[model samples]
Target chain A: MQGRTRNIYLIPYMLWIVLFVVAPIALIMYYSMFNIDGAWSLENYRRFFTPVYLSMTLRSFWYAILITGFALLIAYPTAYLLTKTEHKQLWLMLIILPSWINLLLKVYAFIGILGFYGPINSFLRIIGIGSRQILFTGFSFIFVAVYIFIPYMILPVFNALEELNPSLVDAARDLGASPWATFRRVIFPLTVSGVKAGCRAVFIPALSLFMITRLIAGNRVITLGTAIEQHFLVTQDWGMGSTIAVFLIIAMGLTMIMTENGKLVK
Target chain B: MKKVMQMFITVVIAALGLMYLTFVLNSQQGYSGGNTLTVYNWGDYIDPELITKFQQETGIKIIYQTFDSNEAMLTKIAQGGTSFDVAIPSDYAISKMKEQGLLIPLDHCKIPNLKYIDPRFLDLPFDENNEYSAPYFWGTLGIIYNPEILEGMEFTSWNDLWDERLRNEILLYDSAREVIGMGLNSLHYSLNDTDIDHLMEAKRKLDALSPNIKAIVGDEVKMLLANEEAAIGVVWSGDASEIIGANDKLDYVIPDEGTNIWFDNIVIPAGAKNVEGAHLFINFMLDPENAAQNTEYVGYSTPNMKALEYLPEEITGDVRFYPGSDITDKFELYENLGKKMTAYYNELFLEFKMHRK
Candidate 1:
């Protein structure tokens, strides 16, 4: 009777997954097989393997890596420091508050902050460095992305640190391990799951970022997401868009596998 | 276990009921009553008061929707999900829709105000004999510059934009067609040139002008130019008018080398449920006084020649926005470059953008 009730409870979740997740993915896969003309063909897949797409994929991966690397670098220390603070939860909330604001609003804010007559340029001008073209560059794109993603990176790592028992660190220190060695040998490995989760959270979304590439990068940077959007919306070629999406999905799966905790640690 | 089961069942019932309610509400929203007309247009293209006046005058409810791009509007209509009574799409998009049979033929007998429109706008290549579309507004893609900043430099031809003095002082519109068209026009090639070599040469030439290219941007092009962030911007004539109005120091010019002249037209989609209502709205908009009002508010060139009488002498007299046929004759309307060629142009443009970095 208990088993039957548990199965009954699972029904709604299964339905939700099938309808929203599984079905859409299946539809995309089905669409990927067809060409723009609606004929059944592997033309889109063939095109995906070309140098144009391959190079774009590489560029997108490179940008995603840069964004994730910067985000993790900033977030890890912030998260670690927060764990030592008296009002850590409040600080964490403060970090998350900016994210609650609409993403487009935040992006537009960066536009003003990075504009020629914006504060940064004015500061530079006063300091004798002179104003420079700061907005719509790779640097601005990565900066805004890192800023937007820092909170996501921090939350999981913060949670991991919070969940950590202090005695484990004390035990390591008592054994004559240096602070770096204790962290490297013990605390980090234990919290490795959180780091993986945080990276997964930031990296996956970073790969498919389109709007930032447009508004912040001024279309100078084209990620895989932008190409997918261009194909689907501008060209009205859903097949090509779906084919790229399929590859993105595969890439995401590979990332998950590579970041899987037991496999990486072991 | 029994209590938990009871609570779970109650929650499921409540969720199902909420979903059903939302579904019904959504379906009701799309329900076309006899007196309702749904209009899909570019954001802020029409004055709100005009829609209110239109609704009051005809006793017809108006459901107005706006799309940011022609492609986005086309995709929504092409999907056959929503039944928009009227849509305002640009020249090339009209051709694409006409070819796809997504557009409904306009009934001229109902829209008597069509007589007010200039004959020059009629019987064009996109919709010959005004079959599927009617001219709403038309403008040329041109250069808008701060003459104060540019000083002795005159931007007469497209080549002048490449002057070394203008380095990092030019903003190009972030549209593939206009930017590519500028390059093609400089070389005296057709903007609709299908030859891959000509298209490639255009990209190559544009690449060399990167020193002058400060940034490629969209609607914000107007804001940046008006604030003197850039000395010159390649923009639409209508946008130039708005920018020039914002900052009197700014001036607009249609290059002597020729440029793309685009038209935004109102057309009924194939799935329109209230066809008659759509006609009434189109006719109402085309009325000389209404067209003049829209022209004043939208800051776009009105195609209604009769409406010119109602407009201010300063507006109607401006040769930049309303040029004589001698200059307009050199302008080309963007034709529907077939799917493959359109994609090729987009790809080449993307490559040019990527090359900038």
Candidate 2:
């Protein structure tokens, strides 16, 4: 009776998940299998396999990987350092401060910082390099993407690091292991969940980002996100858009499963 | 205990059911009252004060909403979720709406002020008989250039966009039609050509023009060009008007090769809940004084014949605004291509963008 009563608390949330989440995914799968005329065919998915579109998918994966890698590299150290600090809450707040601003505002702020006559160029000109275009480069695209998505990477890892058992490291050191080996064999292995969690958190959104690619990257980055926008918004081809979205959805599910696999390993 | 659990589940379900009921009811409702008019238009496309004036004169309240793109507006209307009495879609979009039977023929008797609309804006291919649409604002695709970059070099033709010296110094329109249309016009072809071969040629021309173009941009082109990030930007005349207002070095020209002329016109959709209120609103907007105020505030030229008398000569004399100077013969209107052909254009546009990457 007690367990049944507790299960009742989940009904509202389950209803929401059904209405907003599961329903939309089902609708997208339905749309992906049919044309605008409601005729069922594999044409939409076939279009995704064409050479040009295949390249876009690859490009999306490439950018997503780089974003995840950089985010993990930067966030691990910051999160590890935060675990040693007294005011973890204050430090986390400072780390996530920029994300509190609206995304578009953050993008514009990046533009102002990296534009042709922006502060970066002005400072460079003072050092005699002359003004150069930085706002629309590939560097700016990845930099802004990492900037926007780093917070997601940090919080999970920070929690994992905070909850880490310290006696295990001391035990490994007491067992005649060097400090380096202690960290390599004990601490790092224990934090795999956090690293996996951080990667899962950062990689999925990075794969499908549309606005940052357009604003900071100029029209150069041809990722899956922009292709979906063109089909859905510009071309009004909902079927193709849904097809790409279905792929992205599957990719996200697989990523989540991979993180689950990491948890099961322990 | 079983009875308590069942009762708890029932209460939770009832609460959720109430929330869902409210959501469904609120998604749509009859206009606030019989006299309320729901107007859907582009963002910043109208003068807000004119809406207040219309309400004061007619005692009809308006619920105004804005959409950023015609595609978004079309999708909303086609879904039949919202019933808007008045909507402003561009020329090709209005034609698409008409073909889909989403629009109702305007009752001419209700819009008696239609006589004040410019004849040049009437009887065009989109609505040849003026049966469905009335022009609200129109402009041409043109280039806004910095005199500092093109000093003593006349930017009188499309070839100027391809100047070798302009490499990485140009911003093209992000729109597929305008970008591909310029390529068509450069080869002396129609802007609305759906021929596969012609489009292939246009694709080739665009590929060649790629080295010069820094980016294909939308509304951001205004701020970018004004800030001198690019030497030239392809944009609508009204955007150029706003851009030139901000930056002294900038000037606009509709190149002699040809250009797409577009109009945003008002229409009543078939599912409109208040047709009478919509017609009244349209006619009120056509009134000369109201049109002139809209023209001044929106910074786009009006089609009201009598509104010109009230506009300052700066607008009247600006060749980009009035379109009386040169290239009148080169005015081309974008026609609504059927779904299959539209897919072709979209495919080619995607290929072009992919090729750039």
Candidate 3:
């Protein structure tokens, strides 16, 4: 009877996975086999392997790496520092509050904040640095992406840090290990799962961001996501779009495997 | 074993139930011989009051939907799911739809207000004899610049955009055809030139002007230009008028090398369920007073010549928005480049953008 009840409970979740996840991926793979005119062909796959697409894939990977690296660099320290604070939970909530606002609204705000006449420019002029074009640059793109993703990065690391037992650090210190040595050897290893989790959370989405590239990067940057959008919407080439998406899914699976906790921990 | 069999039967029954529910809901939303008209148009393209007035005058419920791009609109209608009664697509899109047999022929007898439209807009190459579409609004691509920021500099032709003084001061519209067309026009070639060598030359010409180019953007070009963030912006004549309206210091001009004159027309999809209601809506919009009101609110050039009497002189008399034949005679409409060529243009444009970084 218990087994039957468990089976009944699993049915809805299995249905959701089949309907939303598995089915769509299968459709994309099926579509990827066709050419623009709906003829069965390998043209899309051949086109994807060309230099133009290869470079874009490389560029997209590079951007995703930079964004993930920056998010981790900022978030790890912030999360670590928050654990040492008195109102840690409140501070974490405050950090997460901005994310609750609509993403497009936040991006638009950055456009103004980074504009020629924005506060940052005014400050620069006051300090004799003078105004410069801050928006639409690669620097601005990475900056805005990291800012948006920092909360996701921080949450996972924060939870990992909170779950950590203090006696482990004390045991290291008690054994004559220096603070740096203790962290490198003890605390970090235990929290490696959280760091992997944060990276996974940030990197995959960064690979496929389209709107930020359009509004913040000024079309100067084209990620795999933007190319997919262009092909699917502007050119109405579903086959090519699906081909890019198939590669993206494969890349994501590889990222997950690389970040898997059990394998890395062992 | 009996328990496992029972579980499998339950799962199959649940799946069937879900599928049946979906089918029922979909059918409910499908066209069912109602006095309802589904209008799919660009967002904020029509005045809200006009829709209300139309609904009141005809007693037919209006189900208005908006799409941001022509391709998106075409995809939805082509999918053959929802039956959109009326759609407003641009010139090239109309041609593409007609070729695909996705549009229905317009019944002239039902749309008497078509007589009020300027004769020049009729019998166009895209919809010869107004078979599949009717002119709604038309505009030219031009330059909008802040005179103060430009100082004594002037943009008389497309070549002026490349002047060294405008370094990082020009905002190019983030559209493939229009920007590439500017390059072609500057080189005295047709905007629709499909020759590979000419296109390569145009791309090369555009590459040299990259230093002067600021951010290539979309609708935000209006806000950026109005705020004087850039000295010059290449935009549609309607957008130029809106920018000028926001900042009187700004001025608009049509480059002497000629430019693309585009049109948006009301077209009924082939799968329309309320074809008569769609005709009624189109005719109501084309009426002189209604068209004038729409033009004043939407700030695009009205194709209804008779509507000029109802419009303010400031709007109708402005040659920038309503240029004479002397200027318009040189303008060209974008031809429906086939799928391969269209994709090629997009690829070249993408290469040009990637070249910027």
Candidate 4:
């Protein structure tokens, strides 16, 4: 009777999940198997295996990995610092502030800060490198992606770090485990779940981020997101777009599974 | 506990009252065709006043929305989830939309004021008889340059982008078709060329120009040019006008390689509930005064002949907006390349990314 009541309370949330998540995903799969003109075909998937598509898929994965690595490097410390802070509440608010701004707005703000004629460029020019443009480079794209996903990475790792018992560290020190050695083995291994969660959060979104990439990277940077968007929007090739989307989902899913397995091993 | 219960009841009553007020307002406005009408159009492309006027005229409240690209608009409409009564899509998009059966043919008689449209725009190749779309606005893509920076160099053709001197000094439209098509045109091939060799050559040309590009930009071209961040930008003539209005040093040129002549048209989607209201609004916009005012505010050319007549001589005579016959002849209107070719172009565009890496 208690189980039945709990399930009934979950009905609204389950309905929401069905409507927003399951429906779109199912539609993507369904559309992927068929051409837009209403004929069933495997041609979309076949085309996706072409060199061009494979190369794009590779690039997206590579970029996402790069962003995740950078995010982890930056976020772990920020999370550690926040966890160590006396005013934990205030520190949490500071880390959460950037996430409060819309993702696109954050990206656009980054562009204004980093573009060729942006403040950084203006300062660079003042120092003597005249007329060098930084607007459309690969660096800017990665920079923006890292900035956007850092919060996602930080929050999860922060949660894990915050939950750590002070006694564990005290015990380590009593046993004469140096600070670096203690952190390397104890703190990190224990925070693996948070790190895994943070990686999933950042990597998945980064791999499929077309809009920010398009805006900051000057539409010159192509990712799986742009490919899907192009197929669906510009070409009206829903099949190809959906196929690309499914491919991305599968790729991300496989990576996540691998990450989880890796965590288990550790 | 009693005070808390009173507060809760008072809050619920207020919420109910708000809902009732909204229902009454919607009914009074006569826009009660449905709960919402999701209009997908270019961001910042329309005059908000026009939307306000449309609502005021017919009690039809508009839930205006925007898309950054035609493709974005098409994607949402194709899914057929959200209900949209009307959409203003560019010429090429209208052709593709009609081909996909996503649009319903306009009842010309219902849009009575469509007669005020310029004859030149009416019988255009995209929608020969204006069957599916009514011209909303028209413009050509060209160079909007800052003379202070571009000082000695003449900006006449698309070839200028490839000039080693101008390398990393020019800005191009971020759209794939615009970038590739103009690159193809610079090489003297048809912008719609489907031949792999032709596309490869266009890609090579684009690659050569890419190293010199400051940025491949969209909406910000106006601001970039105005701020003198970009020496020259490939943009619509209307955008050039806005930039020039803001900064007198900005001058526009219809590149000698010709340009893309784009027309945005109003089309009623196939399953519109507010078909009558849509037609009424379309006709109302066709009025010369309204049309001219829209042209003035939006900085795009009007297809309304009466509106053209009302435009000041300076605007109508502006060569960028109304280019010479020779320059106009070089430009081409984009056509619906069908699905396969669009896919091919998208692939080629992706290829550029791979090459960059």
Candidate 5:
């Protein structure tokens, strides 16, 4: 009876996934297999593997990894602090505030913070420091991606920390393990699933990030999302667009599978 | 009392769910009608008062929407979910829409001020005789540079895009065609080059110039130039005006390679429900006074010659808007590159973007 009730409770969520996520992804697959110009062809796939696009795919991958790595480094400390904080709710709200703003607005706001005449430069002038050319480089893109995704990393990790067996840490200390060893041996393994989940959340979006990078990095940076967007909109070639999209989906799929398997191992 | 509170909670939850359902369904379905005339155009492209004036005149409310790029505007139309009565698309997009049967051709007889448009803008590459599109505003793509930073430097050609002196001080527009087309024009090739070798040449030129480029900007190009984040940039004539308005030190120059002169026009979609209304709106906008108001607001050259008479001498006399006959005569209007060529151009653009240093 309890098993039947649990299945009943899942019905709405299952229907939602079917209608929204599953359907759109399935459509993408169907579209990817056919030529968008009212025919069937694999030319889109053939063209994708060329040196130019392959390099872009690799560049985008590394950029995303770097962004996710930075986000993890920043968020883990903050999430851990929040877990220990008395004002946990307030701190969480502060961490999540920027995520509530439109993504584009936050990016443009970065221009005011990082641009040539922005506050950073003006402050530098006051202190007789550096110049104003730091805002449009590839580094700026990664910074913006990490800023936007930090909360995504923080939330999962924070939840994992919140649910941790705190007494296990105490018992490890009682058995004479150092703080670092206790965390590595006890806390880290328990939180690995959340870290994996957080990494996926941050990395997937960061990998395909386009508008913010385009806006903030000033088009000096290119990612797979921008390439697909150009094919679909500028070229009006849905075949090529769908093909690039398929590759992005596949790359993301492999990453998710690896992360999930890692979580299972934990 | 407990039952009453539970009923109240149930009612509130149901209401919230209904609201979410409505929002989701509405996005899928599209804008519903209620005396609203949806006008979609480039961002900051027109005066709000013009919309108000039209609404007051026609008793039909205006639903104004703006897009940042020509491609974005086209995507919205192609989505086939939204119904916009009036859209202002650039010359090439006008051609593409007409070819795709996405537009309803205008009955020239209905638009009286159509005569006010200079004959030069009428029989253009995209829509000859203004059949499917009415010339709303026109301008060229060129460099807007700060004289203070440029010092004694003079930019006379598209080759100026590669001037090493301006390295890391220059900004380029993010639009693919504008960037690639300038490169093509510099090489004495058509902006719509389909030849692989010509494209390769454009690519090589862009790649070499990429290091000098600080950013590929869009709407923020004006702000960047004004703030001195960039000393020089490729910009539309209208944006050049906005930057110049902000600072007296800026000047827009039409490259000697013959900059692209384009007209963004008002057109009715083939899927339009109110063709007559759209025609009326176009006619209303084309009236000399209304056209002048829009021109003043957007800071672009109006196609209507009669409207030019009402515009301030500073606006009408600006060299960028009313260029010398030599430059004006040399301007190229972008025409639609049919399907295959468009795909080829897109691929080249993608390749350039991917290989960026």
Candidate 6:
């Protein structure tokens, strides 16, 4: 296969990305630079310099980090445990079965689980502890976000763990390394790629959580996605909405660059 | 959703419209997609059986779509090239569409059933003389509260929402206008007032009320209230009716400080292909029985005077559905403040959302 003939297969997928992704992004760029009347301006971006709006953009980044960190903490162990399980495929299936449910439905279910009269609160009442407001707090926001995206973290880490060389761990243990030291020295160092990949998978979606933020997080979590929605859908300010969307896209790109840099460091 | 570049969708829709036009004209006579009407409306706003009946009577196929909000509907039609014959948009949106040239002047002469609509809703600020739109459903914002939770503290004023005694027990409407408008109403300022000091006053009230609110929410407020997770909430009349039905302990009240009255109106977009079909559809929807059916199904108050006779006594007699003139006389309909004021209000709202304690 000559270079041109071999590259023919890439054409279809390249066209798909260009049409669906690149062109739409180009349009957003166009919109971010103009108003509804088609006047060329940076007025939309200028509006975000206010402290309140600026904080929302920053808070969204903080939330993405929080969700990614939490997902890693929980999913790393869950995935590692899955690696030790007898029916690995069946266990993985159970892990992914919830994700297959509708995202909105899942968020609604979280509301039921975390509400004042919910099972958690009922259990608390039974234990002689008073019922507390749990559903609309910042804690519940991250919990649901972590709940929704943890599987993304788990799958990649699981694959990476499954690919671990057994000889390396045995060699570390034979050299008088304790269980923790053997795992840290041999297993952890090699799975950096998977952790990085999982962060990539989890971070971007978590950054743009609009619906779940409203349902689970309540008014407490005003993210960049919420700001964009207010402008575009509620206020009918498309230019402003596009500006926030452009900011979001750039923020995600920067994250990707940072993740790639981490890979380069090793 | 990030890829939904609303600004550039106009061009794409124009191109699609051209292709659609070609397809429509190329087919055989009488079978050439000539008798089809396209409608865009709020989800569950109308009685579906009426649509079926309209199609059966007129022999016109109906293609219907539903939008969740006025802005969403406006964005779709604003993209242009849509052949949507009819759309139901809120009042402020009608003003915006009229200013944007997105709507055509409705032919009142063709719509004889417009006579059946109440005089109160006609010749309003959004559409003077009802030129571009007809009233569909109108409702007011009110406090829906559980009496047992509030310990029989009769709630009547906007300040009641800010009551510190109700800390973390209040559920505020997630809407920028309605939430902030309630504050404006508390201070006796117009909800559409553009004065910086007045808006700042409302902001201060909201900032003060911040500690008391459990959440700022939309439709989810109903379920939360029904579950007794929230003691009180700001909700529209229709939602209040349904939720009150579910939980008998909950009751709806329009505060003495006054609140917003909104209208979901039916209009024909400028580029509609079947203007006659649009008029016919509007007329059919306005038929007293059809309008009554819609009110019953959607649980929103109808603006059609003739329709009131057909509605059940329990629904028509519900004070929330049709509050007394003394209370309703003070209700303010939302005005279209255009771009600059809307931006300011939106900014104020974002600041309120960011308010801590």
**Interface RMSD for each of the candidates:** 2.4, 2.3, 2.9, 4.1, 4.0, 5.6
Ranking by DockQ: 2, 5, 1, 3, 6, 4
Residue B277: error of model 2 in Å? 3.3
Report every candidate's CA lDDT: 0.90, 0.85, 0.91, 0.81, 0.83, 0.86
Give per-residue lDDT, candidate 1, residue A67.
95
Instruction: Show where candidate 4 strays beyond 4 Å.
Output: A1-23, A35-38, A126-131, A174-177, A262-266, B1-24, B27-87, B97-117, B267-284, B287-289
Model 5's CAPRI class? acceptable
Score chain B of each candidate by TM-score.
0.91, 0.90, 0.91, 0.85, 0.85, 0.90
lDDT of 1 by residue, A1-266 (tens): 88998997898899999999999999999999988778999999999888778988999999999999999999989999999999988989999999999999999888889988899999999999999989878899999999999999999889988888899999999999999999999999888888989999999999999988877887778889988888887777788899999999999999998998373332
lDDT of 1 by residue, B1-357 (tens): 688789989999999999999878756765346778999999989988999999889888899899998888888998989889999999989998998999999899999999999998999999999998989999999988888888857889999988999878888876777888889999999999989899999999999888777778888888888878778999999889889889989989999989999999999999999999999999999999999999999999999999999999999999999999889999999888877777788778777777752
Model 3, runs deviating above 4 Å: A1-5, A261-266, B1-35
The reply for model 5, stretches above 4 Å from the true place, is: A1-14, A262-266, B1-40, B50-85, B271-277
Candidate 2 chain A — worst ten consecutive residues by lDDT sum? A257-266
lDDT of 2 by residue, B1-357 (tens): 578689989999999999888767655553354678889999988899999998888877889999988888998999989889999999999989888999999999999888998888887899878899888998898888998876756688887787888878888766788888888888888998978899999999888887787777678888999998888988898899889888978988888888889899999987898899899999988888889999999888788879888888888777777876245556999987766677778778777776762
**How displaced is residue B198 in candidate 6, in Å?**
1.1
* lDDT of model 4 at position B235: 83
Where does model 6 exceed 4 Å of error?
A1-4, A7-9, A35-39, A43-47, A262-266, B1-34, B52-61, B80-82
> How many steric overlaps does candidate 2 have?
0
Of 1 and 6, the candidate ahead on lDDT is 1
Ranking by lDDT: 3, 1, 6, 2, 5, 4
lDDT comparing candidate 6 with the true structure: 0.86
* Candidate 1 residue pairs in backbone clash: none
Q: How well is candidate 3 docked (DockQ)?
A: 0.39
Q: Isolated chain A: TM-score per model?
A: 0.95, 0.91, 0.96, 0.91, 0.90, 0.93
- Give a tens-digit lDDT track for model 6, residues A13-40: 9999999999999999998898755589
DockQ of each: 0.41, 0.45, 0.39, 0.34, 0.44, 0.39
